[model samples]
Target chain A: MTTTHTSRAAKRPATSGAHGRHPAKSRQRPNWLGGLVSWLWLAVVLIPIYWIVITSLKTQSNYYLTNPFVPPGDPTLDNYRLVIEMDFPLYFLNSLIVAIGTVIPSVLFSFMAAYAIVRSSGANRFLRGVNSLFLMGLAIPLQATVIPVYLLIIKMQLYDSLTALILPSIAFAIPLSVLVLSNFIRDVPKELFESMRLDGASEWKTLWGLAFPLTRPAVVTVSIYNALQVWNGFLLPLILTQSPDKRTLPLALAAFQGGPYGVNVPAVLASVVLTILPILILYTVGRRQLLSGLTAGFGK
Target chain B: MSAITARRTSSAAASRGGGVLPWLALPALVAFAVFALIPLIGVLLLSFTSWDTLGEIQLTGLESWRQVLTDPGLPHALWVTFLIMLLSWGFQTPASILIGVFLAGHQRYRELLAVLYFIPLLLSSAAIAITFKALLDPNFGIGAGLGLDFLTQDWLGEPGLAFGVVIFVVSWQYIPFHSLLYQGGVRQIPRSLYEAAELDGAGRVRMFFSITLPQLKYTIITSSTLMLVGSLTFFDLIFVLTEGGPGDATRALALDMYKRGFQANLMGAACVIGVILVLVGLALALLLRRIGGRDPYASQLEGA
Candidate 1:
């Protein structure tokens, strides 16, 4: 209930200014506190990332001997070699397979579904119902559904398969993709649809020629967003796949922490670094699109 | 013969102005039904039965719900999960808002800081967990090497600090997300509003309260809902970091669900907790929606 007042207090030191409102004194005041905290936060975020990258590069013995906060006196890439030898590339390929497998289908299906929901209004109550069903799916927590998903996969004989990971993820991603894409699709002028209709374009033709072009930004956004989710998802792969050969990158990384690499922290961290490198590259390139896409419906 | 006739009837119906909508939406609908909606319905029914991963399921009505009610570890788990959620909210929300406010006002390197802070969000929680798990180890960890021996406690081992470390890692992963929300919200405030406030003798702090915070109400609602739901269901990092160990200190509901299903071989019990989790999430979302009154972006809602 106090989310309101508690939020105000969190703003900090505004009570005195509430009455004072002294423009002159406040104008030149730099946000030193903000600056200090932000920089400190930057370090807090970077340290673990830095720790892993440096640790991954260090000679194992040097990693044991050197200050953890300092760069390694003797750098090495042997850990990467060790991880790669341990089928890290297989796991990476599996992750890529699952990611591409999930994203393409999710984006393609949801685009058609959203297009139908948006363009086929007025007596197309079925489309509207489908749209709402997808929206409700948003509230269904993934963790809650894990058991049933596991059971269903096993029932379908897809357990321990990459196809198992791909199928469920594509299903789960549809809700958000539909929501974001439909939002974009609704903004397509109704006149364009009517014009296409008069021009004798089939629903499919207008959908592909007019609506698809208009919603390309959304298509890209949903594609990257779905890719990120599928790439980073751990639970699905954890429950569905049992074999080392079938394990995705996240499952592989989790494995490195224990079992074979338990004693080799650098090797585990090397795996970590390698696992994130591709996604990090993508994020750097498409940071704006990804952020906006993730927060798409939240603006509502 | 039935399948052939059904296909012919579908073509006949489509040619009769039934439109291509159902056809266009068939793929999504099929995917949703088989994978999402059916699984959801299956979980609800499965919660009433006992089953192992490799064995036959037996219907045992009210038993799993009773088990969830009676399980000693569950309350502690729920309590721990709730505490983490509160701490996370306390940890991430205000800090995000403040940092967001600061960045919105600051001109230099704001984007750079945002990008950097978001690193944790991009990387796998498993990766982050492994890195921190190693870093926090008392014997061989960075804590020992950096000579910040004071900062070096048994991060994931000692019961009290293990929970704290979990909270810290959770915060580490999520704070940037809410901050990004705040930054976006702050950007939405019209520049003219700020100028008007300044001319009316409002200070930065005052303008923030009187104008900025008021305007950011919806974003706050949205972010808080996301964070609360996210914190409750949080699993991957905690799973890798502690495995809910150090005497069951970080046993969140999600972890408990995992244990009940896989470790205890009690699939029914896990689903009960899952249902409860869904209920709690729905309740909170509704509660926050009411508190939030009307969404400021209702126009956008209508656009969709």
Candidate 2:
């Protein structure tokens, strides 16, 4: 941090501390050691991403023979073609359906529930109880309840279907979403609701007209966050789905990697790239929303 | 007198409308009850019974629980989990704070640095694990590319070393997450304090101890709580990467539970381990929340 570095430079005797490395003349001097470490971490983070991107472009011959961390000498799009031949698009479509299916219902339900919880007067006990019930869902790890969830899906004959994945994912996603949406809704001015009520606006009208618009940012945040979670989820699909046709991208990728295609390194990397691209695009567009949403939930 | 009567009727209508308002939560409540609460109760009940994943739910009072308690490999799984949490605290937590502090500055590239670092977080854990699995290949891998062949051993091969590399990978995926937490905390420390400290000639080291750390105490608690619980209960990465191998060297409780239930055909025993995982995670979260004192962010939830 420049603040830390500058303060360090100011505090130390110029003869001793200043000469350890570069001379500090700038008012806001970068911590070179910290910068070095940060860049190294940047490299650590990027090299694999670089490897996957470049490897996806390299021929299988060079993929094994050449250094993986280096840029590809000879490149090809055939790996992506092979990945497509493996029905990567089907898996991608399934992931999209799941993400959309999960986000829409999860956000809608959390929004309405958060509205009820926030709008309920202090004496309203039933709504308060509902709020606490959702709060309790926060700590219930999916791993713990997973076996029973599988049983329930089996009982409903929904096992090995996308429905099984979406239902449980929605359930798991609600707690944090509700907590965040409720907090955001609470920040909405009460007078707006009261005036709407006084003006003979139906509760539904007021809710849709005022609350929805006011909390639209929170809506986007929860939608993107939940979509990201559903897109990236592995355990649910792994445990729930059995048929190859129903396997999500995560399951598909893992199976693709370990199957006979394991030797086809570029194709596997291509699968990885294909699976992750949408969410990466989502992150690029909604970085601030995702960060603020999570930090608000955790920080609060 | 007419105004008062009109207000009373409007207020009465408000209460009547509010009666139907609470029913809006029924969908979420039903989802929670069916998916979260029911399964939670099911896991607890199944812990005491004996059955495979299907068929008759034969209740045999503590049989599965007793078996899990007396199992030979239970301690090792737990120990591996504990090592992960400890190593994460040692490795990930400090790095997170440092990176957080660095990114908290007023520099131009801090934004780019942050976006770059979050790449692993955006991608799926399975993908990251698989890529790292290739990169750690001693010959013809990233280690070779960097010309650090001496630096690249069989990183995931040895028994003791397998668990440690898993820790590194775990930290790699998560350090950015905790760094984001700390970066938020660092930004929350008002700029004026830094200015005053700068004027007072209190060095960076002095300010970090005297000002920064004290301000960040609660955040550190939350970050540590997340790191501990998350690392302890990890499964997916290990599952895809090593399949809990070189011979149970990397099998934590979650992995062991999966293997016991699905692989070994011992669903009831798996539920018992699941119960322990739940209780441990719940206990750890609550205990950390306890140590965290009051929820400082509680006041923020009410209307501004």
Candidate 3:
């Protein structure tokens, strides 16, 4: 334990020092090649997004007649209206339910598990085993497990239900969530936990009152990442759920693309925009936290 | 370091008292075990059995394995999957590293650029595939809309172009993420190293190669592992984009599994593919970890 702690301590200052000196270091040299690539990559990244947004607003006929990059001169909500009429709102609601349903339970469970693993500090054989299991879980492609999941869902008589989607999703999310949350929880000072324990605070209380607050950013990060994954998820929903009304936004988007509305390019693009709009709004409002949190979450 | 002692002293108490800490992990354990672990085992078991989409499972020893191994489609699918993984990894790594180094700078415009760069990350794969499909329709897409005959070729209609489009679009979707990872990795490198190199009068490109690239070894492993493993799960994007069209040009293993299990009603064969996918993913992850000389997460915690 001391060895690990000391090693980590040895590395922390170097990174913090680097942070302080980063701006100056970058300013000392103008990275012309990287700058050129950055701007060029920016164009590569933005062109399609720009095209999608503008084309979605265009009338279907105007879409064919006009430049793909230009915003529609007579922008209309007619495409959006078409999407709305196609039960996009319902699909959006289904996605919301699945995201929320999956996020809450999975995050909560992962938090508890992470708190346990961190607090145990590898002393408990059970937790050590569990931690190793999750570590192994990270390497295995969980997507490959979907076929059996589909079978299990069928066996449980939960086929085609939102619950089927939610169940597998929660399971798939656990490995990464636990890994990330444990990393964050391990960062919380053990002295804090010891002090809280001395104050006669129960482990559960310390978990919620102490560790939870200290790691709120991680909680938020994991929540957003998991939400993004579940919201954008397609395979489970495609396999598990068959009813049109039960479709999530991604499924709905695909249906709209492959079906007759597929040829109605504007309407299809409208569905695409509508599906992404909520997350876009979230990104706009919480760009800083979202970006930093995600970077830290995955980067570490 | 004090936390180590604190945790150490408490561990004895924890073991003696047998506290609620272990139980705290039970819910997640159960969830993962039931849904993930069982399915993993089930995929293997089901591979030995036969089941159509609507039929009862019938035990058939070695039949599925025999079928999958003998089928030429399996090799083709595996080839496609490998091609996508290798090409995307090659394309994304350098680009991500460059953009990451660029964005690691403290510039207001870089932040703005990052904001736009991540937009692709937010969009669902299905939505992205749809947008691109329409944007590359050849008849009414960007080519025809802009009257650029060069851009107007059969982008998705032909085998080679469709394959290239898959790789290109995949890079478009994922480069931002890998870039973010690289950016974080870049920012973490000690400034003194760069300063020392600068004092030696090293050029930017020279320093990038000599210092930056070596320092980002772990990050490269991490990003590459993600790219390789994540490619196995490209079902949503490919399924939405081309549906393995243009004469099976893009029918990677994931899509192959989906087609076999869901479309063609070959559940056993699909499970065989699933097992193969799991093996390939684990093999690649382990191989990368071995190359990196440590498990990244463990090394991160231990500060290796």
Candidate 4:
């Protein structure tokens, strides 16, 4: 037994030393190569974006003739100017309104429903079942629902209205939002709830005072996800709205491409750049929450 | 105490408390029912009938379903969708995992790399499509300038290549998301596990397989399932990049559904396609749920 212990103790440092030495060695020379490869990958990824920005700034004359890699001979905002002049602002506003409009109600509803589902005791199993059913919504691709949604929107006389966009967006967002919020809520201490209950706090008070405050990260995640979905939505908006004034950015841009000036590459790129600015800003700010939120409730 | 209990009881009675919380769900329930559930039901119903937008509806039973099963357009579209999903998911998923693992180790540049990678997520599909269009343009585009002219093709207009371009664009947009998932999962694995693995004389590869891989099982399932469902339903990028293109080369099921339902006014056929999409999504989701049913939070808590 003594010999075995000694051998074990003797083996320990050698293993530890080997383990410690490896990451240290990895941390030295090879790390630089790894970093270099990462940087190269980053460059490859960023090139298309760089090209977009450059092409968007070129004038019509230089756009076709200039080397695509180099900045335009006389760089101009003419493409952006054209997009603005051509009612891109209206599309932008329409998109913003629809996205925000959808996010608010969806978040509110999902929050309360999630609170109820997480806090309620006797119906927990039922709620879980319900939640799973709602998750089935994820499986029901938008293509399947577009026709029926369109018909329903028209029947309700909501066609050509921003309300049509808002309603559908909110509906689609609820499942994921509720899923995220519920998972976050599950993490809150039961002791806190019991303490609040002893203090005569109502469910609403507990939700607003305790749960919402703690679940801010999850809330932000859901909001950003919902916003991205709403902002980038295409098929629903395409089918529901008919008028140019009601068109979202994607629809408007599609029209720009398919219009008489078919494949005006530079102008299209400019419009595309302009449209993505808001989302890019949001992503840059809230990327962590967005990503964690996406993965959190995605599985079960 | 008796007086306080009586007051509480009376207040609770006054509040109509039992229904109030359920009432809160009413707005969302109504919205979902009206906009999602009802439409879905309508689509299922409509799938069994043949109707153009302007014509009288006629009961078609399994006719639309049969056509969807056999239609040359649908089989071609399904093949394209499967191919795009296979290639894009194959390329992007592993790349995301590697990037995620790499970034997880490097604390200093993690945020910067993440931001750079995620920039595409913020951009609109239309914008990405247009940007790619300019970048891939044959004669004067940057692709040509970089001696990539050999790689250049009429991405939107070419039958053989448009699907590939669309897949690349979609993969570029979504890879950051997958990476983020894996990174989160990696962050949740206990540092002690790494130390333990090291103590066991495990090399990096051994540690990754034994410690990291087992711990990240949930994340991998979740991210891959998301990718699978997302890829199968993918529409926006393809719609903008190729518009079911040059000869239906890039026509995904979603796009095909759109064409039939709206553009061609064949609502029944579109509904059938939609049903197929739902079935696929359901199968994938169920599979993912089974794999990820274990406590995902336990790892994070242990790691902490």
TM-score of 2: 0.91
* Candidate 2 lDDT, B1-304, residue by residue in tens: 6345435543554466667667777788888788888999999988888877757878999888789889888998888777777887899877888887777654446777888888777777788787777767776466765667565788778887778778888878988887877777776676578678777876666777888888888789878877777765677799888889889998888898889988887889999889888888888878877888844334335421
Give fnat, all candidates: 0.53, 0.43, 0.71, 0.43
DockQ of each: 0.34, 0.33, 0.52, 0.28
Candidate 3 stretches greater than 4 Å from native: A1-29, B1-7
Error of 1 at A279 (Å): 1.4
Model 2 segments more than 4 A misplaced? A1-33, B1-14, B144-148, B296-304
**Chain B TM (all candidates):** 0.90, 0.90, 0.97, 0.87
Off by over 4 Å in 4: A1-37, A122-129, A261-263, A284-300, B1-18, B144-148, B290-304
Task: Give the higher-DockQ candidate: 1 or 2.
Answer: 1
* Colliding pairs, model 4: none
| Tens digit of per-residue lDDT, candidate 4, span A1-300 | 111222233244356665533242453334343356456667877988888888788876676667677888677887888889989999999999998999999999999887766565324444555565565665556556788888888779999999988988898888777766776776776667767877888878988999999878778777877888788888788889899999999889888867855466777778888887776776667555565555555422
Cα-based TM-score, every candidate: 0.91, 0.91, 0.95, 0.87
lDDT for A63 (candidate 2): 70
**Candidate with better TM-score, 1 vs 4:** 1
Question: What is the C-alpha lDDT profile of model 1 across A52-159, one tens digit per residue?
Answer: 898889877787788776778778889999989999899989999999999999899999998877655524678878977886776657568889999888889888
- The best candidate by DockQ is 3
What's model 3's overall lDDT?
0.86
| Model 3 lDDT tens row, A88-151 | 9899899999999999999999999998887787778999999999998989999898899998
Q: How big is the positional error of residue A43 in model 1, measured in Å on the Cα after superposition? A: 1.3
